[model samples]
Target chain A: MSGDERWIHTPPRESATFDKHAIAEIHRAAATGIYDIRGFGAKRKVPHFDDLLFLGASISRYPLEGYRESCGTEVTLGARHAKKPITLRIPITIAGMSFGSLSAPAKEALGRGASIMGTSTTTGDGGMTEEERAASSLLVYQVLPSRYGMDPDQLRRADAIEIVVGQGAKPGGGGMLLGQKISERVARMRTLPPGIDQRSACRHPDWTGPDDLEIKIIELREITDWQKPIYVKVGAARPYYDTALAVKSGADVVVLDGMQGGTAATQDVFIEHVGLPILAAIRPAVQALQDLGMHRKVQLIVSGGVRNGADVAKCLALGADAVSIGTAALIAIGDNAPHLEDEYRKLGTTAGCYDDWHEGRDPAGITTQDPELTRRLDPVAAGRRLANYLSVLTLECQTIARACGKSHVHNLEPEDLVALTIESAAMAQVPLAGTNWIPGKGGPF
Target chain B: MPTVDLATAPVRELNAALHSLQPSTNETVWRVQNPRGQHAIAVGLDAPVTVEIDGSVGYYCAGMNKQATVVVNGSAGQGLAENMMSGRVHVKGDASSAAGATACGGLLVIDGNASARCGISLRGLDIVVKGSVGHMTGFMAQAGNIVVLGDAGDALGDSIYEARLFVRGTVKSLGTDCIEKELREEHRMLLRSLLDAAGLPDVDAAGFRRYGSGRKLYNFHIDNIGAY
Candidate 1:
C-alpha cells in the first residue's frame, strides 16, 4: 500500500476527555506553573434562555394589535423601603463593571447610554468615578468586600447601593486585578501601590454572618439617611436561601447573578464550574420571594448571559422584575469589533474570542488602561451605539409582549413559555414543547 | 453643646441632626445620652464636630465617620469607627471585634483591651490599643499602623501588606508572610507620635517590637501554595 493509503488505514485516535483544548491547557499549565486566567463568562454551552420559546397568541389566547397597541416596559425598583425609588422606562439595566477593569471612557459611555435609555448604571469594585456619576442620571454604587475607595460622600451621592455578597464568575473567590491593569490612577483609587497584582478580600472584614449583616445594613441606612435603596446581590449558588436571607436582612431589592455572568478576570476553571446557570437559578429565587410574600414588592434583577430582547422577555416572564447586562453591553460599545480583527490576531486571538481583559492590551479600548488604546474609542460614538442597541432590545421586547397578549412586559408569565429540551424544562420548570410534561413537576408522558 | 438623648429621640433623628450640620456650624460640640447599646448611634458624621456618647454603643458606632471626633464613655460593640475618614474615635472601655475595620484615614484609640480582628484591613488608619489585642489583629491590613501596648493574641498581622504593627508585649504567634523587623528610628518616632495621639505619650516607643509584611504574597506564586 502507498504511504498515504497506509496512514489513512490506521489513523490516530484522540481521547474525548483530553481533547485539543484540554491538552493545550495542560501544556500551558505545565509551562507557566499557573492556572489559566481570562475574562468573560462561561464559554461552554448549557441550559439557557435559548432553550425556551414563547407560545404566541392564537384561538385560545387573544393577541393585542401589533402596531396600534402599546406595551409598557416601565419598572420601579427600591419601592419597598427607600424614600426614593428608581423608575426606569425599560426593564434592562447596565451591570457593574469596574473603572479599573474597563477604561474611564467606557464607564462614561455606559452611563451615557443607560441615561439615554432611562435605565440605571452600576459601579463596581474600584469605586465611583466622577465622570460616571456626572454622566448617568441614576447610579447604583456597589459596597464590595474590599471597600476599596468606598466613601460616605459617594454613598450619599448615589441613587442606590448594592451590597455585593458574592460574584457569579467566582462565587467563593475574590476579585483579581493583575499588575498590568494597576495604573497610577487605579492604584490611587484602590490605595494600593502601582503595578502590583491586587487581590480583594473574599469575605468582609467587619461583619461575619447574616445577623451581623443586618446591623451592617442598618449602618448603611443611617449613613445614607434612608434616602437611597439598598440592593443585596449574590452569586447563584444557593439562590433560595440567599434570596430569603437578603430579604430578611432588609434589602430593598435582590440581584441574582448566574454562572454565565462576566468578570474582568478570574480562573478559567472557576468561570466554568462555580455557580448555577441563570435559567436554573431564577425559579428558585422567585419561589423564595413568593413564599415570603414579596414576589414583586422586593424587585428581583436577573443577570448572566442575557443577550437580546428574547432573553430579557424570557427573564421577565420567568418572574424577574428586571434584567441586567454586562458582556452584551460591552460588545455593543465596541469591545470586539471586526475592524480590530488584525490587532486582535497580533494578540493571538480573534475579535470574538479575545478574553484577555486582565492583560490591559485591548484593541477596542474598552478594557485597557493604556492611554493610546483608550483614546481609540470615542465615548460619544460608543455611547450612541449602546443607546441604539438598547432601543432595539426594548422594541423587540415590546413586540414579544404584544404577541403574548400582554399590555405590559411585566404581565408576561410562565404560562406563555415552553422548553424545547427536557433539560431546560427541568431547569426552567417550564413544560416541554409538544408535550404537557414539565420534567420534575410530574406530568404523564 | 447640644444634648440629644437616645431614649427620648430615635437614632434616626440624631443621625439626621448630625448630618444636617454644616462645615462651619457653631454647634460643634454635642452629647448623646442613654445610648443603651443601640446600633448605629452617631454614625456618618461629616462635619468637624465632637460627639460624646454617655453609654455603651452597639454595632457600627461612628461608622463612616468623617471630620468628626466621637468619644465613647463606655465600651463599644463590633466595627466601631469602621471606615472613618479624617477624624478621631476614642473608646474609653473595651472594644469588641473588628475595631476600626477598613478605615482609610483617622485615629482610633481604645483605652482597654480589644477583641479579635482589631484593625482588620486597616487602610491608612492609625490604631492604638492601650491593652492587649485579640487574635488575628491587623489581618490583611493594607496600609496603617496598629500599636498595642499589651500582649497580642495569636496570628498577629496575618497576610499583612504595607501596614506596620508594633507590640510592646509578647506576641503569641506571627501569621503567614508577617515577620518581626528591626524597630528603626523612623518607626520609633511613628510609634511615639501614634501613642501621643492616643493620649499615651508617657509610654516608651523603644519598648515596642515592629512587625510587617515580608514582601511575599504581594503577587501570586506557585511556590507560596503552602502558605495559602
Candidate 2:
C-alpha cells in the first residue's frame, strides 16, 4: 500500500507505445493465440477531412443567402458507356453492406432510406436480397470474388454493377463471415453449409489484372446488354493507378474506399494498418482522371469516414462525383445506440465502442442475424431515421456550398478550402490556413 | 438456320441479334461464321435457341448464357461459357483458362483439354472435360460436379466446398482441405449421368476417383493455421 500510494501520488505514467490497450491486446494474444478479428474501420486518428476548413465568402467574394438561394446537390453516375445512367437527388449514396453481415430488416431499411433520398443502395458479398431489391428504387449489384448468389437475372434487373476488387478495411485480404453470422438463409444464398465460417476470395477466380479486367467488364456489359452502369470499386491503396486502370477497363464509375471505410469482419491489424486515408487518396485519383481527360466522364465515388455534410462537400470539391457511406449509415439507423448500454456492457463493451459485429449479437438489431435482436428493429422506423440523417447531411453540404457562393455543390473547388495542418495541405493540395504556402506546391506569399 | 458472319458485322451486332430473339421466336437455330478469335460472342442469350459458332472464339464466349445452347466448334479462349445460367456450352477443341467459371447452371462439355482454373468457383454447373484439365482446377468450387476424363493439374479442388470432383486419370496434387473420398453408388450415378450428358455414355463411372472438402478448413482454428 505504501509503495502503490507513493506511485499514485506522482500520477502513473502510461507508455505511449505500450499503453493499457496494447498491454491487454498482448495478453489476449498470448492467451488466445489468434489475431483479433473485429468489425468497423481503423480506430487510429489519421489526417482526415477535419484537418481542412472552408473559407467563408467575405468582402472580396459575396456569400449567397442560405435561406433564399438554392444549391444544387444532384449528381449523375455511369453515363460513360451504359445505355441508362443513374441520377440521384443528393450525392450521398449507401455503400455495400452484405445481407449476411446485416439483418434483413437493416438491409431493407438501407434500401428504403436510399430510395427516400432518391439515391442508390448496393448489394454486398452474399448477393442481392429480395427485400432490398423490392425496397430500393435504384440498386447497384456487387460482383464480388465469391460470386455468391450471382444470378444473371438479378444482374439484368440491377441499375448498376460494382466489381469489388478490394475493400478499404483490408485492401489485399478477403472477406470473413464468422460461422456465428452464417445463418440458414445466408448459407443458402451463398451455397455453403449453414454454420461454416465463410471466407471470400481476395481475387476473382476468372480474371487477373487490368488487361483481364477489361475483358471482364466487357463480359458484364454483354451480360447486361449494355443497359446497366458498370463500376469498379478499389480500396485506397494505389488510387492513382487504380483509377487509371479502372478508366482503361471501361468502367463508367470508379468507387474508391479509403482506410476509414468499415468492414463487416476483418483482422483488427489489417483494418488499422492497411490503406491510405480518403484525404490522401482523392486528389491523386482526381489527378489520374484529369490526366486521362476522363475526369467527369468516368465518375468517381469516394467513401470512408465521411461523417457530415462538410466531408461530403470536401469530397465533391476534391473531384469525387459522389460519396458513399457505410458506418455512418449504420449509426444513423441506430447501431451502437446509447440506449443499448446494458447490452453493450453484457458484451464487454460500451455503446460507441461496440464493434464486435461479427458475433451477430448486435443489441440495436442492425448487424446481428439473431431473430430476437433482428426483430427489435422495425424497418420502417429505421428507414425513416436513416432518411432523416441523409437529409440533414445533404442540407449541411448545401449550407457550406451556399456560404462559399457556389450555386452547385460541385462548384466548391480547392480554392474554397484551406488546411489547418501542413500534412493536410499537401494531401488535400490546398494552401495552409493564414498562409498562401502549400507544402508541395510553392505559392505566392 | 440463320447465319451471321462476324467478319462483316461486329460481335456486338451478332449479340444484339441473338438477344433480340424471344422465347417463342421461330429462329430456333443460328450459325456464326468467320472463325476469328473475337471476344464475347453469342453472350447474354436468354432464349432456348441453339448457336453454333463454326470456329475458334476468344474470351468469354457464350458468357452468362441462359437457356441457349452455344456450341463452340473450335478451341476457345479464356472464360469460356462463364456464368452460364442454363442450357449447354459444348467446346469441341482445347479450351483456355477458367473454363465454365462461376457458372450457376447448365452443362459445359469440353471435348478437348482445358487450361488452368477450369470450372473455378463452379456454382451448380456441371463441367465434363473429356481430356485433361490444367492447374488449380475447381478452386473454391461451391456446388456442382467437375468430371475430368483425363489427368488433372496441380492443386485440384483447393478450398473446395460441396462441389464433387470425379477424375478418371491422375491428379497432380490435391489442394488444402481436399481429399480422396469413397466413390459411393450415389456419386457413381451422378458421374454416370454427367458423363452421359457430356456425350460419353459408354465411359465407366467406376474408373473415376472422387475428391472433396475434408471439412477441416470450413471453420477456422489455430490448428489449421499451416493450411492457410
Candidate 2 global TM-score = 0.98
How do all models score by TM-score? 0.97, 0.98
After superposition, the stretches of candidate 1 with alpha carbons farther than 4 Å from their true spots are: A1-14, A442-445
What tens digits encode model 1's per-residue C-alpha lDDT throughout A1-445?
7767866666677889998889999999999988899999999899999999999999999888887999999999998889899999999999988999999999999999999999999999888999899999999999999888888999999999999998788898898898889999999998888888888889998998789889999999999999898999899999989999999999999999999999999999999999999999999899999999999999999999999999999999999999999999999999888999999999999989999999999999999999999998888888899999999999888899999999999999999999999999998889999998999874311
- Candidate 2, residues A293-366, lDDT tens digits: the string is 99989999999999999999999988899999999999999998999999899999999998999999999999
> After TM-score superposition, what is the CA distance of residue A253 in candidate 1 from its true location, in Å?
0.6
Model 1 Cα RMSD, Å? 2.0
A199: Cα error in model 1, Å: 0.7
Deviation of model 1 at A178, angstroms: 0.8
Off by over 4 Å in 2: A1-9, A442-445
Each prediction's whole-model lDDT (CA) = 0.93, 0.93
lDDT at B186 for candidate 1? 95
